[model samples]
Target chain A: MENFHIDGSTYIPRIDFNAETGVLEIEGESYHEYTTEFFGPIFSWLEDYLEESGKEITMNFKMSYFNTSSSRRFLEILTLLEEYQNNKEGQVVVNWYYEENDVDMLESGEEYADDVELTFNLLPY
Target chain B: MGYMEHFSVKTFKQQLAMKKISLAFQGIFSQDVLALIGKSLRNTPESRVIAKRLFAIVIEMAQNIHHYSAEKQYSEKDGRDIGVGIVAIAEDDHHYIITSGNCIVKTEVPPLIERANYINGLSPEKLKEFYREQRKAPQREGKPGANLGFIDMVRKSGNPIEINIKEYDETRSFFILSVRVNKELQN
Candidate 1:
């Protein structure tokens, strides 16, 4: 499968999904207007990738800021990964990175970690 | 209060100035405009925590207006209709007050007031629980705001949302919302 990559902007995150290595990373801020439209293709890509590959996947989230709607989308992504891991398709490891001083981001990561059964790690940068 | 007394532009302007409002904008709340406002807030000299809260609140408030305001404006940049509203940030010794006002259909006042009152009644933990529950639930049809922005603003500010609804005309009312973020960090 081909890789998926989208550059970051002032209000959108950068998406880099490497099909070969199974490393999916989203970094930066996400507060765009068309959140559902923007994430649609990314969700489709993940579903297709998970179906095609049996390799272990690593997901990295290094987000500085994201609005409420984006927060829901992120939770959806984590839930999808949890389901993948639960079904024994392959191992899934999620690394959620936040700035050391951003307590809100840190708390958000903590909450996400609590909401899913996947191997979630909260890393500070 | 009577319609004319609901919002006096001169009095409002004086109140904003007296409250030491640092930034104010009145126009279409397009995504581009929201980004510019975010940039300005980030550049403010407040502590990182306060700045972050301010940024989040501003986005939520502006987006609410963009989605639900009764006033609409066609934006050439966005190639679509956007909401028109007013937003301001004022600072005192202990708090930064973020206020936003927009026109809304008179019929929307009851439900909006109910939602605000419900959110204001919740404790911090309950607010967080409510936020997570609503986030997990499917989006309600035809409701883009989803009340998540309101919950989030209150949760982040750790304060009750103050709302004022005044009849603007026979069919429309003016809705004003203010959220206060303590300058000192809360545990």
Candidate 2:
């Protein structure tokens, strides 16, 4: 499968999913008006990549800010990863990065960690 | 000329200054406009401290107007229908107040009031639990958002969401929402 990438804008995140390395990264702010439109293709790409490749994947999220709608989509992504890991397709680890003083972001990561059964790491920058 | 006869920019400026409004916008709530407002908040020194909370509240309230406001304007730039509303940010010594107002159908008043009251009554822990529960649920069909905006706003602000509904006409009512964020960071 081909790699997927999109440059981040003021209201959207940078999406870089490398099929060769099995390393997916979503970095920057995500407050786009249409969350589904922005995230739908990425979800499809992840599904295809998981089905096609037997390699382990690491998803890194470095978000400065995201609106409530985007939060739901992030949870959906985590749920998908949890399912992929559960099916024994390949190992999956999520590194959630937040700023050092951003308690809300850290707590958001903690909430997601509690919700999913995947290996989730909270890293502060 | 007729409308301009009574309009006074001086009076408007004075009113804004009196209210301590640092930023204000009254027009269509488009994504581009929101981006500009967000950038302005980030760039302002006084607001930069509370920018995260202020921005989050602005997005939720503005998006509520964008999605559900009764007043709609077709934007040639966006090539879509956008809602019209007013948003303002005021700062005092300790708090930044974010206020947004828009028109809504009169029928939406009761349910909105109920929702606001319910959210205000919840403790912080309950609010978080409610947010998570709603986040896990499937997005409602035909809705543009996940329906967790209000809860999330209150959670982030660490305060109750205040709402006012005033009768605009027989068929429509004006909806106003205000949230306050502390200038100093709080745990």
Candidate 3:
């Protein structure tokens, strides 16, 4: 399996996924112009990885901020992971990291959690 | 009150004038205006922050005009909203005052007024927390409808949000929010 890496920015987060440990880390602000286009490849990569490798996956997300477009893509990613888990290929866990004092981010995670069958961890960084 | 208020050429002219209020983003009406505005705003220390927030807020506001305004027009390449509105930025003794005004449906006024109240009541620290809480919660019933853009703009601006609402009609109302970023807090 190949890992994907993205550089971080003030307005967007850097993403790094480890193929060995199946641990994916996304950190940064996430308002992007080209929404699904930017994430399509990442989603395909993950889907293929889980389908072929059948490995357990865990993702750690530390985002300072993100726009609604990005938020939609995040859910798409989670939905993809849910599919993988439901298929029984492997288990996937999502750990959402935000500042302890940041209530909006926590609430956002909870909202996303409500939709997915998988569990999401709300962690303070 | 009249349907023409929504389409009056004057409305667009005023919005354009408000654009000029920020020399950095003003005089930008071209295929590359967004890119140009981005470049100019990116050059300044304080304006950079304001610029990004503007990107999000304006998009939301423009969308609101497109969807809700009881008017219609398609003159601009992007079909700029026909809603009567003005968005402005000015400097005062200390902070930069950012203001935006537009006609809204009467039904839309109360929630926004409540939002403005909620935003003003919080301190910077609390605002930050509110932002996090909002982010962590799943999106409201619909994603686009969530008021995160407003909250995010307030959080990014680092200023108290002030709002003014008046009746344009029994069915339509005007809404405005202005905030100042004290000079001391800005670099």
Candidate 4:
């Protein structure tokens, strides 16, 4: 598997998905014109990665902000992860990192945790 | 650039900032103006970055205007609602200022003001924590539609959030928010 790296733009976040470590990390802003267009491949990769047996996946998200369109897409990602965790043999962990003072971000993560079946660890960095 | 003009829809003058910028924009916050500024930010790297952050901020504010404003009409783009507003972007030596202005009713201002008051006072670390908690919590009224985007913008930009409110007319007034993104902090 190959790694994917996208430079973070002011309206977009930096995305790095490593096949070697099975760690997908995304950070920065994401409010693109076509929100779904940008995330299509990302969702696919996650789905494909889960096919590998005994593969440990660690998804880290340290974003400052995103838009409504992007927000819906984010929920889709979380949902996918939740299912992956349920069916996969290896352990999967979601590390949601936020600023210490930003209640909105922390709470956003918490909301996702409440909705999804997976257990997410909300961490402040 | 030297004087203020009044019209239903107008755009702001393009500016290049080196060090510092304030949190107020002096032009109409119409979609045309936002598009105009997006074009201007294309030339420089930092401004382009700042411009994107500014765009997200405006989207949220405009949505609030569309949803909460009493006097509003659907734009020509089918049913996309629009509200009267203004946005400004300025820069100097150290920081960048992104200001947005829109009219809101007296009743609507308090809750928004309270939220702004709560958000502006948090440190970067706390803001992140708050965001995480909010993300993991159940959907609150008027939250699922807007808060997600707002939180995303705050998390991606390496700056302090600022907000201010003032009255303009009966049952309607102006709400402006100025976000300052420091140059020295992030890349």
Tens digits of per-residue lDDT for model 2 on B9-121? 88999999999999999999999888998888886564343577788889988888888889999999878998999999998888888999999999888998899899989
Q: Could you list the chain B TM-scores for each candidate?
A: 0.89, 0.94, 0.64, 0.67
lDDT of 4 by residue, B79-157 (tens): 4555556555666576656666777777877876677667767777787667656655554554324355445546555
TM-score of 3: 0.55
- Candidate 1 deviation (Cα RMSD): 4.3
Error at B122, model 3, angstroms: 2.8
User: RMSD, each candidate, Å?
Assistant: 4.3, 1.6, 8.3, 8.3
The alpha-carbon deviation from the true structure for residue B27 of candidate 4, after best TM-score superposition, in angstroms, is: 9.8
Candidate 2 clashes between residue pairs 3 or more apart in a chain or in different chains: none
How much lDDT does each candidate structure score? 0.89, 0.88, 0.63, 0.64
Instruction: Kindly report the docking quality category of candidate 1.
Output: medium
Candidate 2 C-alpha error for residue A72, in Å: 0.8
User: Residue B34, candidate 3: how far off, in angstroms?
Assistant: 5.0
DockQ of 3: 0.15
Best by DockQ: 2
Candidate 3 lDDT (Cα, whole model)?
A: 0.63
Worst 10 contiguous positions by lDDT, candidate 2 chain B: B43-52
Find the number of clashing residue pairs for candidate 4.
61
Off by over 4 Å in 2: B1-3, B44-49
- The CAPRI classification for model 3 reads as incorrect
